[model samples]
Target: MSGIHLAYDLSFTHTEGRWNQPGAWVGSDFPDVKMFLELARTAERAGVDMLFFGDGSGIPSTWRGSIEPAVEWGIQWPRQDMSPIIAAMSTVTDHIGFGLTYSSTFMHPFYVARLLNSLDHVSGGRIAFNVVASSRGADAANYGYAQLADHDQRYERMEEFIAVCRALWDSVSPDAIERDRATGRFADPAKVHPIDHTGEFFTVKGPLSAVPSPQHHPVVVQAGNSPRGVAASATFADLVFGFGGSLAGQQRHRAMLDAALVDEGRDPAAVGILWATQVIVGRTAAEAITRRDTVLDFWTHEAVGTMLSHNAGYDFSTLPESFRLGELREEIIAANASPAGFIGALVTELGADTVITRDEFFEHGFLAASGLDHTVIGDAATVAETLEQNHADTGARGGFMLSSPLAMPSAYAELSELLVPELRRRGALAPRYPGSTLRENLAV
Candidate 1:
């Protein structure tokens, strides 16, 4: 087995009211701080590599069958902020790396540089940034834009934005800071360089206000999964997330990304490829299947529909279960051209008869129902073997960003207790975090 790292998705804001039934659980039922602390402890104790938070600026109005909007959809609405939460989590855990998603479209590069630098110091150098170009109109409205920019245009702006951020981060060298008590002098002026950058999208002046971080720069994680997204990842990202339903499909995507990195004059080994998998582990295959079925029995159809509606950019709730893939593909293409163009082609290649019922889409991707890929459900040893095989076959450096069934903490416990130990015994998963910094853990 190659280097296998673990990451768990932490969503502080729980979707309780969105369900049709009144008895469904929500954020109020489970406290975010408690959940976060538990997850941090659990992951650290299990020797997990990282804890990643997926965030968004706004909720889609179509999610609740209302243009007016009923529930807070994304991270910003539920959590309000992430930096503070990450700071708290960092203090509570010892070794696990921390990561959060931030958009280049809405934030200033200097501010982002300063904040991320501070996070790196606070986390003891365990920090990563997942760069994204916001696609929602609501997020654009908050930033004073009339509408969201076109997909390609956003990516182009992102390229300049990331460049400016990197320059700002490198402006102040680590040796520049000197706490000289006798002369009361701090930070030598000679070592601090000003980034007087004037780009197409932004103009920034000078060094970041914060001192240089231990990691030099936060690990860059990109997850666009489109042609333009792949190109950007090749140029900028240290790790790129790939989307697919099978090992073969994932390998093809990985090859494409690797080729893109080579074309951009980057070392392919420097960029890790991580595939998303929803995991279900038990003592045996039968036990795992039973657990999965039990969870599916209680799965809320309405909640699933709401999530799909937000992603597909239309209310899938109203569509018939027997809706043709061709019709849905055309509709999605007409609505949001870029995501549909990329996703539609991939979906067709996987197989069009892949019916995307509300239940199936939420369980994993639409094609997961075929059992070809997506969710990895089996006993501890079986799941470990599969992970080892996939890593060996694909040359993917990172491990599964394990998506749980319902609650973040509960799902984490299952993986840590069952799958992780088995992988360790097989010499697949790391026995301990190899280094103090996020980069070291990933590189190991």
Candidate 2:
């Protein structure tokens, strides 16, 4: 089996320390650039595969309300841009891959291709693209659209968008440049092909402005679990991100993705699977539990209600907290009939009693076990052992994308000091990066 590909989902605007706090955005703090560089270096030393950013173009008014209330009530908030920070981080770390999230819905394919190509060059082929079709309705308006595109339509546009980008990358071959200074000739025009791509969503005239990077193209990653989302990923994604309440559930998702990939005429083995996880580890299980509970206690019912309302796009505040689970599912179905089926499936699996009220849901959501397939809160060796079992049982391509509940740097520091060394001793972690590019690291 392949080794675990560990990664940190860094938020430029949503800093790591406020992860468990409702309405807390990590990126807002503008954590010292030096701090980010050091953290990247730490992950590298700890044998992480990549340090990635989760981003959005605009904040919705609903979320803004939550933030304002939290601020007035003396709560924490985080926000920051991830692209330039990763670029800076790359200069300070040797082998770790850096990823930036860019929405396919807002940006042009030509611009995205050129920007990422330059980043790949600057980072020496250690860059990746986390493609997203923006979820927030306000974000679309901010970008000059009257309303956000429907979820399925966004995926349709993304399909054509990615195809064009790939073609643009192929347009300018690496060897196209001649650089004959004496003759005042630079590149071989004949070698640089014109894409002349015309598609349903996008049209490009010629080759990309920038040359292809050493990695050839940045690795493409997708993070969505809906049916349309699965189809989009199956067609182009190199990695798929999934969320589940149990190991069996995660395995089911993996099977679904594999089937989708096979349908696309792509080898399932070529794509990697990463589960999102939040781990709180300490010297003892008791210590870990205490820490986890402390974070959960900070989350209030109002905060959770606000967060969920924004996510579901229906005001849950007006609804009764004592609303029955069946009633809530029906309400959700009425509001967004598309994802209702998936939501209903989750509620059924977790059971009505297990699902919490709007207020309780926010607090419960912070609990590692509530959302993650595997939650490790114990001694280092025990944590490492559980990870090994998970890998063996599921045959997942990689490990979790670690989420820090609080103090991003400190959480990672603990991971480095406690978890990493033990994993190495047990031969579950890599002592050094196996290759130079993100593709090579993930593929291996």
Candidate 3:
């Protein structure tokens, strides 16, 4: 890899815990074609490789078994479809790929394949489908499931899901598109083949109706930390979005993913693992700390608790402010298995007897407040140095997915003008986007 690949984890909802934060155009600017177009242009100019939009399928109803807190906090709700925004951005920017979050848990392979295949062609192959195996119960309910499938089984669903999509994408060969105007023939019928796939989770039939795009199939991106998730990524993902936190945690993730890839009969280096992180930059270290503090100040304990309650599938609001992990054993099992495991990990680190008060959990457990478990906060030089060194240490070729909690444009502005240039100078950032297509740029 020439340099670290950076992607903006694009948020469609108003950012920051508070809606009225300065520079927030929550009601007006969201889903605005022009606003996203400008954002895409700015990121592309900054040598950002992709605009990866994170999405959820349903409104969060897990918190207190109510959607009020999620709606009140704007915690990943009021969701807008990313397809239109991606289409608009693709028209204006040539090199910035669009990574769209679509769940394998809910959607059929044929639908996903057709939608992305068309998008890839329209975007000149600057598109990636960020495959997610849906986790939330509310999301499952919307998709006709009484509850989310068992964790390992969900990954099995994902494995079959991607297999069907790949088969559909490959159904029509690249050479199938002949476009012979003289003969009034747009494609070669002989080159098209039916997928006819019937798996345990899904039954997808026939060749895709659409022709193949530049990349054939848009880059497959997966972000699952479970063992089954690693296997799914190893089998299908071109790029893996990793959970960011400790150097050790990420290293372990990469090691397992690499091992999984080898087990799947693929080269370890062929896939990319991108860490999901936040960049808090300032002109000076103190300034960066101040900025980070300001962002933290916006997160209220209740807001964070509500977010966590939705994520873990247990009502934090119902628990006492001071509760021990042992007290919630039954509730923990009732919650999602992955989050229960996360709690177990935290207990192992902090001692299971460790009391997890609502205040602490609120302050540190909410993803945005938690900085997705890892955050880089410093002056431009320090931030660049930390990111470079960590990337070097983690052995992740696909780099950081940058975002800010404050919904401030200035953070990104500083990144473009200060931090990104510093990384480039250190030979850690790509000098320019390598090519017009996402695959080409990522291949660099």
Candidate 4:
């Protein structure tokens, strides 16, 4: 395995939610296929191992029971399905893999299995699935649910969802298909067995309609941070998307995931834990910070409140400005599956006992809104040093998932021009993919 494996976390929107900026290409140009193809080509040229898509199925109405801010700022609305884009991009690149997100909360496993399997075959074993449990009520409503499933219940459903998909994927053995002209036989019936699976959430019968695609099963990726989420990742995920707040925080999460793997009777090193981070690089430190500030300036108090309320799944606008967040722990927990782990983080930043009033929460959110979990801003050398140090300190064999605030073209170009070369020089970035499959390349 290379010292650090890099993947690009891509979104179709303006990078980091800065919309309507003059001369910036975002919403109106998102559907342009030419732009996506070039972006994929750029990432492949940078030797990026995979292009991971982060997806949401619904427009936000959780913020003060309103979708105004999300619609106004283009905060993850007007979303498009990424499957076709993945197919198009895969045709243009040989080795760069694609990770597509699908939620277990709404879709049937059989359909998902077929679609992703075909994509994997078409892409020559270069595709992965980022499994998610849908949390928003809007998404659940669209799927015909009155309210979202309870937090743990959602995870329970997901476990069964993955189980059914796995069985279906393995229903047809590798040697099942054979074109024999002499006997006029196409496939060996004995080799293709029925997966008569009957679980609490899903009951799937027989083998899939299509033959087994390349990679047998596309790489299983998960970003479950809650207890149930961790267990699901440990049991089924090939790659686990993780948080990167600090070296200590990263190390703690890694340890928990490793332990979960042990409980599943799997080797700790078998699963790759990838940390998602945002980077701002410039010719100098000051230049980078200036760019970061420009991004941060977009986070007004109202914007912060809207974004926070949306993420936490609770309306902060309903609470008084002087109310202490500590007292509402239970309510927050009840509100969302992964209640703003950010709330806990904000409290930590302000001191443990500090009351997180509405004003304080908005201020902190506004300050840090532009940055991701582990934001790095610096010149190329400084950024490289920080990444290398974090990798060493946290023992992250899985490496980092990078996002550039600049949209696709600028982001990919900057990475190829500035950051990736630095990593290559330090022997951190892999010179080439080890094999045709994403599983082979991401193996640590």
Q: Against the true structure, whose TM-score is highest?
A: 4
Residues 96-116, candidate 1, lDDT per residue (tens digit)? 998888888788888888889
lDDT of 4 at 435: 90
How much RMSD separates candidate 2 from the native structure? Answer: 4.0
TM-score of each: 0.85, 0.87, 0.92, 0.94
Worst 10 residues of 1 by lDDT: 16-25
Error of 4 at 250 (Å): 1.5
Better of 1 and 2 by TM-score: 2
Query: Residue 98, candidate 1: how far off, in angstroms?
Result: 0.5
**Residue pairs with clashing backbones, model 4:** none
- Superposed model 4: Cα runs more than 4 Å off: 12-28, 347-353
User: What lDDT would each prediction earn against the true structure?
Assistant: 0.70, 0.69, 0.76, 0.78
Tell how far residue 169 is off in model 2, in angstroms.
Answer: 1.1
Among the numbered candidates, top lDDT falls to 4
